[model samples]
Each structure stands twice: as C-alpha cells, then as structure tokens.
Target: DIEIHVHPFALSYCSHGYRPQEVLPFTGSMGPFFNVFCATIVSLSLWRIRNPKLLPLLMWAGTAYIAEGVAMFIDIAGLPILTDWGKVIIIGGVSPVIIGILGIIFVTIGSIFMLLLMPLENVSHRDSFGKKYLITTSISFYFLLSVIYTSIFVLFVLDNRLIAFFSSIVFSLLLTTIYNPIFPFLDRLSHTKTFQIGWSEVKIALGSAFGIVIIVLVFF
Candidate 1:
C-alpha cells in the first residue's frame, strides 16, 4: 500500500489516457532513471562542496542540494517494488516505509542545514541580486518546477486541475521558504565561468530529456 501511494499524484499524471497497468512501464522506467540522475546531482554537489576554493556559502548550498536530491531519490527508488516485481532488489530487508522515513530525515537535516548556513550578515548586493533575494529566487524557481510536476499529477491523476494549481502555489511557497536561507552560497560559486556555463548546459540537457520522456509517454 505504501507503494500505491508513494507518488500517487505522479502516477496519476502519467497514467492519464491509459489503463493503470499500461502506464506502469513508463512510470517505472522514468522514476528510477530520474532518481539515478538525482543521485548523480547529489554526488556532484557534495564534490563541489569539498573544493576549498569555493566560499562557505557555496559549500552550504551544495550540501543543501545534496540533501534535496537524496530525499527525492530515496522516495523514487522504492517504485520498483510495486511497478516491477522482477526488478525489486530490496536492500538488506529494507521496506518502502523505511526508505520513506529516511527521506524525511534527509529533508529535516537539509532544512536545518540551510537555516544554519544563512549569510544574514552578507545581505549587500555583491551580485546582480542581493543574498537573500538570490536565495529566494533560486528556491522559488526550484519550487516552481516541483509544482509543475505535482500539478500534472493532480490534474491528470486526480482530475482536479483547479485545486492542483492552488495547492501548488501553497506548496511552492512553503518549500521555497524552507530553503531560502542557504541559496546565497551560490553567488560565490557562480563567479566561476566554467561552473556557470557547465551548469546551464546541464540544466538545458536535463530539461530537454525530461520533456522528451514525457512526450514519448503521452503520445506513444
């Protein structure tokens, strides 16, 4: 039952226009692949955090990103149990509930870490945006992406687009506030041309791939 409700909204979104069983393959494949990508992002952020050249704020941002990625991945990784039994590779007797609990732990720790790393003293506008402003913007953008996905789930799966839109606004506000403090660490990190260019490319590539996957599922 945990699996049934894990990403109930997401599953609903992807299953639109198809029988429940029909969408399992698409959801199953997409879920794990996206989660693996999250794991990669977490690893990369942690690696960036280890670089001494980066400022303390940037390192904190990396740590927060890692927490966010890990939390999402943990939840997504549990999908195989229900979607594809043949691929259900349990980890030392761990259950879906246990993994969900672990994800919650990561979220709590990440939220606290961001709060601790807030550069309240450095509120001046060193970059195009002030520290707090940058953090708020970054969190808002990320939350918006999340809202898009959740809204799709609610709209298609739950057949309540109106409620989904309103709920997404509230969810985005809450999540953005939760991570607002730690985003300024990016100001220092973004100074590197290599990082800026590379990150932009990475985002574009991932976004394109995600769109392609969705189109494939919906039309084919």
Candidate 2:
C-alpha cells in the first residue's frame, strides 16, 4: 500500500510503499554546522590579513557570510517546531528549542556588530577609495536584497527546494541588472560625504531587516 505523508514545513506530500520501522537520520543539520564553521573561519581570516584599503568590502563580505550561516541554522532547527504543535520538542535527539534560542542570540549580536562596523568602515575609508568602491558597494547591497526576496518567494511557491534555490539565484541576478542604469547617478552621488554616510547606514539597516525577516519566516 502506498502511504501518503505530508511535510508540515514544506507544505507538500510524498508517498512511500511502507513506513520504515527505524527513525531516519537527519543529515540536514550538517549543512548549517558546516556553513557556520566555514564562514567564521573566512571572516576571521579576512579581518586579520586583508588590506586596510579594502576594509569596507571585507567587513561587508564577512558579516554577510556569518548572517547567512546563522539564518541557515535557524531554518533547519526550527523545522520540527513547525511540524509539531508543542512547547517541548526534540529533533535528532537534541532540543531544537535551545538551538533556535542560540541562533537568535547570535543573529542579534551579529546584526549589531554589522550595523556599527559598516558605517564606520565606509566613513573611515571614504577618502582612500573612489567612485568604483561606492558604486560596487551599492550594487552589491541591491543584489543581496534581490536574492533574499526572490529566494523567500520561490521557496514558498515551489515544492522542490534545490530548484527553487537556483531559480531564485538566476532571477535575482536578472532583476539586479535593472539597477545598472542608476550606476552613473550613484557614482556622482558618491562624491558627497552626506550621501555616503546615509547610504552606508541604510544598507546596514536593510541587511538587518532581511535577516530578521528570514528568521520570522522560518519560525512562523
């Protein structure tokens, strides 16, 4: 007999010939652990050895990776909570509630650190860098926002996670190209101190907002 099982998190159904007697091992947790570990190492390495002139770029890259890792961890750990309606829960023999709490703490700290670091790095290095850096940074932030929005939308609508992930990435890249025409305006605006400072702050704020949105989506 074909047994139909609905996945609460994915909001999709699958079929199996027979119910397995043994509990299947969840290998999903490994991806987040790997992401966190690699990102931490890369961030630390960039801070220690990267050129001072590239401070803003390095800081942005480092913080982005760290945030991504933390987001992934929260998403994976929170899946069980969505499936079962209970305050007390366990997944893979560990309490995902605890993992979710820790993920929140890490995200909070990381966001605050990024908020402080982005503006300071931009202001400090403004004189050394040129219009290229400013334009690049602006476009990078825009691209990131596009990716996040697209990924979330696609993941919700599509049943296949891998296909949704890659499709979002491709579509995000196409969407970001729409901003190419504004590059000239951004380059001109880069000459002003006020605009630079304001842009830096805005970018960091949006970044933090996206992180929070991801966490909320995963949990709720």
Candidate 3:
C-alpha cells in the first residue's frame, strides 16, 4: 500500500497554484518531445564515438531513460482510469500507483545491474550455462532489490518514519551480506561470457518500442 500527498492547490487552480488538468497536459505534451530531443542527441553522440568501452554505459543510460518515459506515459494513461475507479484494485483493474512503482523499480534495478555488468561486456562470450546463470542471478538480484526498496517505500507511505529508518539500516546490512558473496561469482561469470549480446538485442527492441510510443503519443 502506498499513500500519495498532493497539494490542494495542485488539484484546483489557485491564484498562485497549479491545476492538474492544465498542468498535466502541458507536461505530458512536452515529455515525449523532450525525451526525443535528448535521445536524438545521445544517438548522434553514440554514432560518433570511437571507443567500444563506452557503448554499454551509453546504451544503458538511454534505455533507462526511454523505459522511464514509457513508464511515465503508463502512469499518465492510468490516472484518469484510476480517478474513475475511485480506489485501487490489484486484480480486476489497473492501479496507477502500483504500476508506476513497478516501472520505477524495474528501470532502477535494471539500469543498476547493467552498470554492474558493463565492464564484463567486452570480455565475456555468450555460452549456454553463462546465459542461464546470468538469468537466474539477474532474477534473484532483482527480487532482492525490489523487496528492499518496496519495503522502504511502504513504510514511508504508511507514515512510519521511525520504523522506516530502522528498516533501512536492517536492509542495508542484509544487502551487504547477500551482495558480497554474489558479486564475486557475478564477476567471474561476467568474464566467462554473460548476457551482453542479449542486452544489445533488448536495447534495439526498446529503441523500436520507444519510436512507436512517440508515434502514438504524437498522432493518437
């Protein structure tokens, strides 16, 4: 469960306040344009780059940005439906909050993992066992990160500041314990060939999806 606090003035247009209906449209209209602009610059920069080492980091950043933009649009689309529904529904209907949180989590964790694995991209050659190990390790890491982050988010949403603080400390300890052993194994696996090639394919797919998103947002 999560609680969101919106300023009263944000809902209604006060003399000095913003209104959602007006503001959302303006921001929504600009969001894709801004993303496209940034992406174009990034694409051009990548094209001109001579170094192969920088590719992973650049691609990771671009993909993460595109993912975040897509997630934002998802949340935006869900907002009106959420207002109509008047409450959160997990099973039967869409929940903007849950969806949004999920998007954030995926983008954050995926980007972090990509960064962690970037150094291994050049050295590792894809193999059957390596791919399986990569997939399993990725899933496990993602689940752990989700739990740690979501627990903190829930505590804050529940307005349990004190508990959240303590939980953060506990989670940090737990994370260190889990991460220390796994990292060495991950590093070894990375040298033997991880899923870097697969990531390239995924990046291409995401780029195509982003283009489609832009088309939809602009025309429909």
- Which is the leading candidate under lDDT? 2
Q: What TM-score would each prediction reach against the true structure?
A: 0.33, 0.38, 0.33
Q: Which parts of model 2 have CA positions greater than 4 angstroms off?
A: 1-26, 49-90, 124-220
Pairing residues by index, what is the TM-score of model 3? 0.33
Worst 10 residues of 2 by lDDT: 82-91
**For candidate 1, lDDT tens digit of each residue in 1-220?**
1222233124423233434433333344344445445644553465434322332323343344443445345435645554332132242334556555655665554444443333422332334333444553444444455457756555543333334345434533554554434445544543222222245444654565456456645654
Error of 1 at 5 (Å): 22
Q: What C-alpha RMSD separates each model from the true structure?
A: 10.2, 14.0, 13.8
Top candidate (TM-score): 2
Q: By TM-score, how accurate is candidate 1?
A: 0.33
Put down candidate 3 lDDT per residue, 1-220, tens digits, no spaces.
Answer: 2222322111211243444443232333244346545654664465344233444334544354534544454444655543212223322355556646655665455334443443344323233434324432432443354456545554333333333344444533443344434556656543323323466655765576456545644543
User: What tens-digit string does per-residue lDDT give for candidate 2 at 93-118?
Assistant: 55665656766666544443332233
Worst 10 residues of 1 by lDDT: 1-10
Backbone steric clashes in candidate 3, count: 1
* lDDT of all predictions: 0.42, 0.44, 0.42
Candidates by TM-score, descending order: 2, 3, 1
